[model samples]
Target: MARRPLVVIGSGLAGLTCAWASDPQGCILLTAGVLTDGAASMWAQGGIAAALSPDDSTALHAEDTWRAGAFAGDRAVIDRITGVAPEVVRLLVELEVPFDRAPDGSIDLALEGGHSRSRVAHAGDHSGAAVTTAMARAVRAAPHVEVREHHTVTRLLADASGAVCGVEVRRRDGSLEVIETDRVVLATGGMGGLWAHTTNPTTALGQGVALAARVGARTDDLHLVQFHPTALDVAADPMPLLTEALRGAGAKLVSDGARFVDELQPRDVVAAAVWEQLTEGRTVRLDARGINRVATRFPAVAELTAASGLDLTRDLLPVRPALHYSMGGVTVDDTGRSSVPGLWAVGEVSRTGLHGANRLASNSLLEAVVTGRAAAADAITWTGVWRGSVRPADPATVRTRTCTAAPAASRPLPLAQVRETLDSACGVLRDGPTLQAAVDCLEPHVGDDAAYVAWLIARSALAHPLSVGAHRRTDNVLPEGVSA
Candidate 1:
């Protein structure tokens, strides 16, 4: 019998990188929509963080990450990931990612909030799009890899041994198909869509977390979500992001025609500051007129502003805090292996403890590439050493635990209600009563994936009462040694 191909779910940065690295060993890449369309990775405007400059070092990078994350992340993991970051950038350059170059023909770096040095390697402001597009191109040309667009994975099938043996996917035509494979990697991005105002695709409803949690994968820090301070306050359903790189390039966050908060502080701090302004009924705008050649330097942000009938140079772009990234997710080790056997997770779906209470700016892309490559390498090794035969379980059995088709009584609340519940309770500032109320509201809808993940975040937030990093609880008094 032919060897079953390893299956990778989601087609974001991590998924693409994993599929690209699998190469001759091969794997099946699955995406719910067209490749790169719905991915938060493509929406990323800030670049990947790396210590490539002469003034910077991995140790400094690790320190900045730790400080930005509020010292809640694993030091060892931070060190390892930051150590490998420079090498990762080198590899991306070789992949023809077309990163912006300096006058000296060196990779152009940008300064962002929470970084001690100019370490972000970007291709204009559309760094994520460029990098993801390059990787997608590589995956398409790989002879060994099979690309299956619109194959939405519904369930992870585990055998009697409690090991993932296959997955059940619903094709574009609504027909279910089963692929038998011992190794499965979930790179399904973050749960930003659970909030009403998010920069993520509305479809990113935390399906990866739900799938992993149901299969007994360890999840941690589910409540620690990072909000971006400068999502353009427009009338769009999902808000358009004004990249932090703009602020780095001399843009100021102003309200009442005066600068209020430091633009280069950590995201949590800046987001809170922005939130405070909005709460006080003061309009906050990002003034980027001072940034030289704004349109040429950041074409993506220019286009986003243009669509809203605003010019980057002439307008003070209205801004507000919006749900941006998740710091908490399914727990994984250095090689991106989950606690469950034959199961691995990468990207925002997998919490590798590099971002503790909050994520450092531009670190998500770095983590995505690192974990993706690591998972691919380990998956290849596992397939080589473990040649155990496995059969696909009944597709019906797999769908039994899925969120779809739940009985009316236990069905999930509408996405609007879910968003309203979370948005009211879980913003930049959270309190005990609001969090408890959110938990109570979402408890009954645990059968639904969105509700389940939202419940997890609310529960986690309520359980952690301290004001640490992004999971700030306004009702709690900080302990003697703890930083608020």
Candidate 2:
């Protein structure tokens, strides 16, 4: 019998990198939407982080990463990921992804919050879209790689011994089918979409978390979700993000038209500071008046602001803390292997211990490519023996659900009730009682992917007693009632 193809579940940079690195002839790429549009990667505004400047080094980058994650991340993993960051940038350049360049032809780096050096390489403000478009072009030309769009993987398939075999997919026509495969790489995006106010696509409901957990894969740090402090406070669902690059360009955060928190502090600190102001009913906004050629430097942001009846050059854009990134996920090793056998995770889906609590501004894109390559290299050679279990499960799938299905809704749970529950219980400030209450309220809806992930996040928050990084708890007060 012929060997089954390696299945990759996502279209983000991580998934694309895995497909390009793997044996293309045996690689199958699946996307819940169009190849380039669905991923949160394309929504990324700040660029990839790298220590490529003359005055910088990997050690400094690693130091910044460890500090931003609140010292809880694995130091070794930070060193490994930061060490390879420069090379990742070079690879992207070679692939014709145009990074912004200085006058002397050096990679122009932007200094975002929590970084000691200007090491983020970007192409304008649409860094994610530009990079993803270039990678998608390359993948489209690769004849051996099969790209399937609009096919949502509802569940992961595993044998009785806990070795993964395939996935249950929801097709475009509203029918479900199963694809049999031995290797599965989940590059699914973060759980930001579960929150009422987030920057991620609505479909990014942590399907990867639910799918993996149902099969007994271990997850961690689900509570360590980073809330970006400057999402444009409009009436839109999934609020538009104000790029950290603005702060790097000298924008300031102001309340009552007066500056308050330092705009370039670590994300958790800045977010909490902003949340304090918001709770006090003060208006927080990103003041971008000082940036020269603001529209030219950040055209995408200019467009977004223009649509909202404002100008990045002249307006004090109202802002608030909103769910931006998840720092914890299905726990994985250096090679993106989850505890479960024959299954791997990369990108935001896998907790590689690189981002222990709060992620540095641009480290996510770097980790995506680095870990994606690792999982692909390992998956290419694995012989389907997971953790010493030699059970030879056939690559045949069995469908367990009825063919009919309801059209997927944008919000997973009761939109109004769950939003209030998550924002109040798992928002910037959290406590034991509220976390437990949020879990209890959402427990009945755990069958829904969004609600299940929200429940997982709340449960994780309740389990960790101390206020560390993004997982802040009001009740876990220290000597000064602040983090050390």
Candidate 3:
């Protein structure tokens, strides 16, 4: 029997978890950039959501997740993920992940927005970093996994019968290669980089969603983009995130010399409040003085503030709302299976309805672990019954086309124009006229870089007339009927 190959795309928690669970003897892992580059998994400061506390049950965690998702979440998926979270955390611990522990040697937990209890297991303020680094180390040591850096997947290849077979990749050197495989898993991160101001790496340009869409996969809830309420507004272009855990630790948000607002509000509400402050010509600041004594509790936050030339003890760190996560992407089933046969998606790349209209704090990473592992198990079962060899196609013979590709002589729209248009029309506040204008402006450059991203965001935003979660439309005020 010929050896079957499993191809996993992206190097974040979801991709890494799938690779680890698949246990494929000789698997090929494709990443668009370096392991640490452009991955939202590394930028995450909040801890993972799990039922680690004796007071916290999986039912409570699931309920919280469902509530935070605006009741649009799939209940079965929520239950499945929350149920496995504790075990997933334990597995990470056994892998040598140094999660912060209590004095009694139990896992330390913290609270964040939308949660009823302190059920977040963290590693200081760098939980995502700690888990990502640890997982990457394990992946590197695994003899069966082959990590391919700087390989961009341009398209997913499906057979004439509409079954996924492999992918066409554009290498770092601008050369193309086709890798044949029996199964493919997309773990690519979110579409935050498409926005002007975001905490995600610039490389997260909705490539995964676009690629999946190109292959005729069903996508869902594309308008739901989460905005972090407190990204440090400094010289940083993409912006630096100040974790919500700071609020959990008692930090407050206030305008210049004014009273502070409640710090425990939902991210969408808090982000909108911060945006309103900015629109009113008032700079927002995160007051850390009250929580300065516990600054040692969050070493990463303290170190980042100090590195940015601000002393938590004396100076207030400037903050603003920035695009953070996407609650939509290629649609997947309960087991992370996409509509396309032989293909699965996990993590931020797949819109499994687990997040619905809004994502709960820290649940993004939890979904990645749970769905990645489930996808791997499902893929193994799928490949067992489906036996077919995929032959590589000649690079020159296969069409080298792009959704944005135009005639060689035609001048393409500039990226700067697209960015400015999105910033002005499709940003924090939206009206029907402005959104329509945005669609009109983006229609001309449909296949262009900025236009493609703007198209997805604008179209999706337009589809959901009611305001929900991070997406807000001034013209279409959400009806009272739509309750959270």
lDDT against the true structure, each candidate = 0.88, 0.85, 0.79
Model 3 scores a C-alpha lDDT of 0.79
- How much does each candidate deviate from the true structure in C-alpha RMSD? 4.3, 4.9, 4.8
Q: Write candidate 3's Cα lDDT for 291-347 as tens digits.
A: 857568877877888889988777888999888888888778777877767778899
lDDT (10s digit) by residue, model 1, range 77-170: 9999999999999999988999989899989999999998999999888899999999999889999789999999988888887778899999
When summed lDDT is taken over every stretch of 10 residues in candidate 2, the lowest stretch is 395-404
C-alpha RMSD in Å of predicted model 2 compared with the true structure: 4.9
| Candidate 3 or 2, higher lDDT | 2
lDDT of 2 at 353: 92
Assess candidate 2 and give its TM-score to the true structure.
0.93
Candidate 1, 416: how far from true, in Å?
Answer: 0.8
**Descending-TM-score candidate ranking:** 1, 2, 3
- Pairs of residues at least 3 apart in sequence or in different chains that clash in candidate 3: 404-447
Sorting all predicted structures by lDDT, with the top scorer first, yields 1, 2, 3
